[model samples]
Target: MFTFEAEFFPDLTKTSVSEFCGEELSVLLHTLRRNGQLIEQLWNLVEQNGAIKLYCIAPEEDALEPRHFNRYGLEALSAVLQKSVRPPVFRVIGKTVGLSDACACENSEYYVLFSNFAAEYSPVSCGDCNLPVPLYKLPGENEDEFYALRQWQGEYKACDSLFVLSGVGEKFGYREISEVDSSLTRDGCDVCREMSQKCNRPFYYFLHRHISPLETCPRCGQEWGLDEKLHGFYAFKCDHCRLLSDSP
Candidate 1:
């Protein structure tokens, strides 16, 4: 389970499709609705409660140090959000500090997070204000891959490092990773899955999510790398199906 869910669920409603579309991120909500796996995951999802509760966590495996949290969080999670699951632009309520009014619209907004999981200035809260958002919550067996990955990364501490702000490098790593992933999308296919899917013809190695950076290529039964070299040959062993070779 995403610690966010187990910890502060009341802040998050168990959203329905209509409920989902009601949020600021309706476009992405609709996209998730059309995709079977995404829909199934969200069907049982819950939301977190309150802004302040973000500081709470399960016990860390290592002793807590002041800088540890300051160093690792935000850097890691931002990268994961932008690279792995590009969400959409979420606007925050803005205020100008001494001026007693909101900041001007054009200058204050940070639309950088315009995809699956967005991070932007917190518009609503006063003082210690932020909105921690995960694009969708996957629950039960549907959440297995995510929980396993979190555990493997060392759970709370890892999550803090990856998602919270502790280090300079980790802060933008997720965004950097987003650039690396741009190459792996279906549009890069020389034959292109979109055209072929419409044509009702076979296509080259395609991918579906098993987890990050390791996806099973539907046509070839091989695991394509998420790195720069994925399309070149992509003969890596399938993590999902355990199949070998890109040879068809």
Candidate 2:
């Protein structure tokens, strides 16, 4: 992963952006995030020394290239920079050494999941290397690329967070997130199918089961347990349902 900084000298004297700074900046960040140009919603907005700097983490050093911007991202970026005095300057601040190495497999399967406990930015990960697959590397139409998948990530994260709290919403959140027949799982499975067809590779939908004892597929009621675990964690796999869960 690469850390990048975009510095802007907002001329508050000419056009006061203080009123719209928060709103406009949020829109810009969301636009970039949805397009997969930016990883996660995590960022730093700092104002110092007569400059406003936005720091972000990206999967690739060139992930913020102009060509990567969808129409909305472009417009948002322009709006934010219009408040600047001498245009905006962007550069890679540094590289990040993460827990998992970047996906390097030539032919690898994929799984889709998001955990509130993990800092994994991408919801899609290579089944072979157990590393994230940057959304831009996947096939999709312009502007709407990975649109549904990205939406699912946000929704899943919310549910995941609630489940982690383990309070009043725990059962509700857990069922919504991990149950195969739940709306969230259904939507995520649909996204996996679409991504699989687009990339011509297996895209499995991860079902979070902390200590499931079921030997049969929850959806199909057929045996799906593997002789040994796949990817060191997934002990059950249902090809028909495109689902995976850990052992009991």
The top-ranked prediction according to lDDT is: 2
Put down candidate 1 lDDT per residue, 129-246, tens digits, no spaces. 1121121211112222223222221322332344345466454433322222323222223322332343333222223222244344444445444444333433343434322222
- Each candidate structure's TM-score, on Cα atoms with residue i matched to residue i, is 0.16, 0.82
Clash statistics: count for each candidate:
28, 0
For model 2 the local lDDT of residue 167 reads 86
Query: Where is model 1 poorest over a 10-residue stretch in terms of lDDT?
Result: 121-130
